[model samples]
Target: MEKTAFYTVKQIPPEETYPVRHPVLRTGLPLATCEFDGDDAPTTFHIGVYIEGKLAGVVTILENAHSRFDEERQFQLRGMAVLEEFQKQGLGQVLVREAEKEVERRGGYFMWMNARKVAVRFYEKLGYIIDGDEFIIETVGPHYVMCKKWK
Candidate 1:
């Protein structure tokens, strides 16, 4: 299959993102474990990248506040994951850029996430900076709170 033939990224329903989010971000856990807080909020949005009509990557953005940010508009990015077969193909970056655009359009001043330690470099390459000390999320592993500000 031509890599470009069937690739696209767009906003998707929160439920539609579960398949990719579960396997990648919460492997071996119950499907319910993949559900995130604020996923159904009016201010929350989900983005997905599809290849060959299947969900290949997913991300969730919540219009929430972080005490660390004094900005009036803050978004918490959560459940960002891409299938192993699709990594390094730029799908993750595409999803993140699209999400950032949405955030900017909605007047968001900052975006933050508890990013996995393994993915810190990836976020850094996208202009996100480590905001705090490394921490753990129970069954999950090491993570760092990373943030990016638009203004």
Candidate 2:
């Protein structure tokens, strides 16, 4: 891991996530495609990982429940993105870990996401588990529900 002053993770406004999300998560789609529901909700928060002062990754967490999870206070992890040039340098893992801490701090008992099939192993490395069968998301390809909890 590149553990140096070059990296910083902090809370940011939803708009700040677009720059990273558009390319990393929605490359061929319009930038507006990156916008998601509940993005500006009172309980939603966005986190950005910067490399030498440039945004290198982003993630969003919002209050939502998954029927499979019995936990009353649940948060959904969404729009996680790491620029292609920065992949494998551990930024994606850092983004998710920070989001996990923030959610637990806010009283969330668990969190989940529709993880892309290609990234399933990545989330598993961070202690997230596949919760269901894989399904296709129209323009996004295959995905599997994954969940994790720290409370």
Candidate 3:
């Protein structure tokens, strides 16, 4: 791995996220798991972090509301993943920050996610708080509802 890795975050089309998401997030699961609802909506945006011109990470921001949050201006962070080789390089952080900025740009003040248990600490480090009881997502195992709000 190079110490000075070059990476850029850019908004990408929803379909372009399948490759990274399927390998990083959905592994044994069906490829369909990577296709999320609202993914192709006009208000929804997908972001990919490209390193050395290869897609290394991806995150989708949907202008959708979570029932738990009563706020009207809210967005959901879905299918956030980084390639195994790309993990721990702070690319995940960059993806989330870029997604949050998009939410903020659209007048959204709240962002929430069904964060995998293993990634809770990662999201926590980025200022997201666990919002409710932990639960299982069947094939996906345990997850927690985490949220970050900004004015």
Candidate 4:
């Protein structure tokens, strides 16, 4: 058991973040899109938790989402997960809050993310709105585009 500290994904050594990437993609589902050139900047925004200096969890922020109705700048939340050993300890909330703070710091007014259908209630509890009908994203599963305004 260890205490958690916040970190900018970019601040962590790339190698540490890499291990959590695939695991988050697998667990987050439908909301986790395929790695389209995983190294691309627009495809990711990152935050994490470290316990005793070990990377314990990660969350990502994405911008410019694709919409059937309109194309506009929208911040997307992705890759949100805590290591198995870290679950249910409130670290997930910490990661999300920090990510939101970073988005605001970056001049981002709107935050968007595809929440897994199962996790829709979770985002809703956090003030996210579900948009469009359910859709299946390739390499991922089924999810809806969810967004929230940063106040």
* Consecutive 10-residue window with the lowest summed lDDT within model 4: 1-10
lDDT of 4 at 8: 25
Overall local distance difference test of candidate 1: 0.88
Error of 3 at 40 (Å): 0.6
Write the residue-wise lDDT of candidate 4 on 1-151 in tens digits. 2232543233343345556766656655432333433435744556668766667787767666556424355677767777777777766777777777777777776777777787788778788888788988776689998878755
- Give the clashing residue pairs of candidate 1, or none: none
State model 2's lDDT.
0.89
Q: Give one digit per residue, the lDDT tens place, for model 1 in 1-151.
A: 1245658777888998888888898788999988887899999999988887888998899999889878888999998999999988998998888889899989876899989999999999999999889999899999999999876
Off by over 4 Å in 2: 1-4
lDDT by residue (tens digit), candidate 2, 64-128: 98888898888999999999888889888888888888887887768899999999999999999
Residue 94 in candidate 1 has what lDDT?
84
- By TM-score, the candidates rank as 2, 3, 1, 4
TM-score per prediction, in order, is 0.94, 0.94, 0.94, 0.74
User: What are the per-residue Cα lDDT tens digits for candidate 3 across 1-151?
Assistant: 1223478788999889999999988889888888998998999999999988898999999888888888988899999989899888999998998888878878888999999999999999999999999999987889999999988
Stretches off by above 4 angstroms in model 4 are: 1-10, 13-15, 27-38, 42-44, 68-72
